[model samples]
Target: MEYFTELFFSGLTRGSIYALIALGYTMVYGIIGLINFAHGEIYMIGAFTSFVVATVLSIYGFPLLSIVLLAGLAAAVWSASYGYTVEKIAYRPLRHAPRLSALISAIGMSIFLQNYVLLAQSSEFQPFPELIPDFDFMEPFAHVVGSSDLVILLTTALVMVGLTMLIKFSRIGKAMRATSQDRTMAMLVGIDVNKVISVTFIIGSALAAIGGMLIASHIGQINFFIGFIAGIKAFTAAVLGGIGSIPGAVLGGFVLGLTESFATGYVSSDYEDVFAFTLLVLILIFKPAGLLGREAAEKV
Candidate 1:
């Protein structure tokens, strides 16, 4: 039972990060029907943003809490700019063109950003400072969770609740839903689909920043290349939960995290990736619509 509790909490922490990243994937795909392959790069940019900001702030002797908040703010701002610019440069031009063109452009941008980061930062891993200081309050239940993991869970819960409220009650949320349902109709209704799409990118990028920073803090090390593998896994999570469904993305993230955790614990750590990929394949084959995804019917 103790071992199970350990793995469960660990999986939940990882899943929270994955879900945060996965939401960006689902939102972009839902609104634009384009997979922003460069999104992972945006996440990488966010981590770098946090690293630089936190390091600089540390030099001035700021408290850990202030440093973490300000660093997150800086990362959010930087990633927002990247998101807006990427949409304009890489995706906006190909909106009316073939999907393949947009996909290719996204891939090109991904590679470009990856190299750009490698050049700007180091090609090697960088240590992430302790953003969330350890606490002994959870010492009694160390096997189940710790203070850091609790913070992660609380942060994820708050973000999700806020997002749900924004999507369900806000006017922009209404426009977003309309645009995702039917762009032509949304534009006809004066929703400004393009603006909606841009906002989606901005919000998604900010969310990605949060995920990146959280994961960086959790792992204590980061590099330019972490985004590539993380992006691939998040993409799989999006697909597994149904690409266009926000709730589905979250569900998929938890599922993937739990799957990997159990695989590592019961099976072998070496086969963790194999188990995840195998599950993806099986889900694709058995239920292509995804667990929470609605089946689409197209007319010829």
Candidate 2:
């Protein structure tokens, strides 16, 4: 029971990261049907940005919490800017082209961003500050929450709540929903489709950026390739949660996170990724749409 309990919380923390990144995948897909392969790269950029900020702040003798906060802010800004550029440069021009062309463009953009970062930051891992506290709250029960886990969980919760509010009550939120439902109709209704799309990218990127920052803080270092596997996992979570559903993404992320953690604990660590991908395949074959996903009827 104790082992299960530990695994559950651990999974939840990981799931939170996946959920944040999955939001970007689901949102962009909902609004424009683009995969935004470069989305992962944006996450990598955010982690690096936060790392740099934290390092600079540490040099100036900032408090630990302050350093993490400033790092998050820097990450969010960098992610938002990167997302805007990706949409503007890679996706916007291909809006009228064949869908395949847009997908290819996304791939190309992803490669370009990866190489750009490699050139800029190198392939070596850059260390992050020790902002996370090391105390375990449930030491008595042999249950413990590492500082990194706590930060990841808290950040994920705050971001999720804020996103719910943003989508539920805000003006841009409504516009986004309208655009997602029907782009042409949204344009006819004077919703400024392009602006909504841009905003969607910004929001998605910002969330992913925060996720990246938390991940870096938790892991204590990051590299240009950090986003690759994490992005894949998050995308899988999005698909598992019913691609365009916000809550679905969150649920899927949690599920996937727990599954991975449990696999690592029960099975060999080497088999962890294999188990995850195998589960993804099984879900696709059996559930098709996803755990929370519903099938859309064909329009007559």
Candidate 3:
């Protein structure tokens, strides 16, 4: 039972991270119908930004709490800027062009960011400071779940709730929904579709930034290539849950995380990727639209 509990929490933590990044992918796709492949690179940038800020603050003898807060803020702001810029430069021009053009541009941007980071920063992994302190209250369950895991789970829950509220009640949320339904119609109805798309990218990038910071802190090290694998998994999670559905993305993330966790625990860790991808394939075969995804008819 203790072992089971440990694996469960581990899976939950991993899922939370995946969900955060996946939200970025899903939101971009929902609004623009274009997959922002560069999103993973945005996440990588966030982790790097947080690492730099936290390291600098630590050197100056700032309090741990202050370091964490400032680092997270910096990561979000910088990542959002990158996301917005990517939208304008790489995607906006191809908005009315063939979907392939936008996809190619996204891929090119991802590659560019990865190589840029590698050249700017060393290719080796850098140690990430332990920003999240172990809480005294969590001592009892420390064996089953670490403080970082607890923090990740709680933080993800809060983020999800806050996101839900924003999309449901806020004016921008309404605009986002309108834009997603039909960009042309949204513009005709006096909604600023471009602004809505930009805002969606910003929110999604911010969320990814948070995930990047938390995961980097949890893992204790980061490299330029970390984003590639994480991004692929998150993208898989989004597709697994229904690419355009917010709730589905969350659900898919948790499910994928648990599957990977249990597979690693009961089986060999070497086959983890195999199992994860196999599950995705099986799910797609049975339900093409996704677990919570509804099929939509194309207008001719």
Ranking by lDDT: 3, 1, 2
Runs in model 2 lying further than 4 Å from the true structure: 135-143
Best by TM-score: 3
Q: Determine which window of 10 residues in candidate 3 has minimal summed lDDT.
A: 290-299
Please provide, for model 2 over 81-138, each residue's C-alpha lDDT reduced to its tens digit, 9 standing for 90 to 100. 9999999989999998988999999889888988898999888988877767665664
At residue 237, give the lDDT of candidate 2. 93
**Candidate 1 structure quality by residue, lDDT tens digits, 154-269:** 88888888888999999999999999999999999889888999999999999889888888888898999988988888888999999999999999999999999988988999
Return the top candidate by lDDT: 3
Runs in model 1 deviating more than 4 A are: none
User: How much lDDT does each candidate structure score?
Assistant: 0.90, 0.88, 0.94
State, as a TM-score between 0 and 1, how close model 2 is to the true structure. Answer: 0.95
Error of 3 at 92 (Å): 0.5
User: Candidate 2 — number of clashing residue pairs?
Assistant: 0
Q: Per model, how many backbone clashes are there?
A: 0, 0, 0
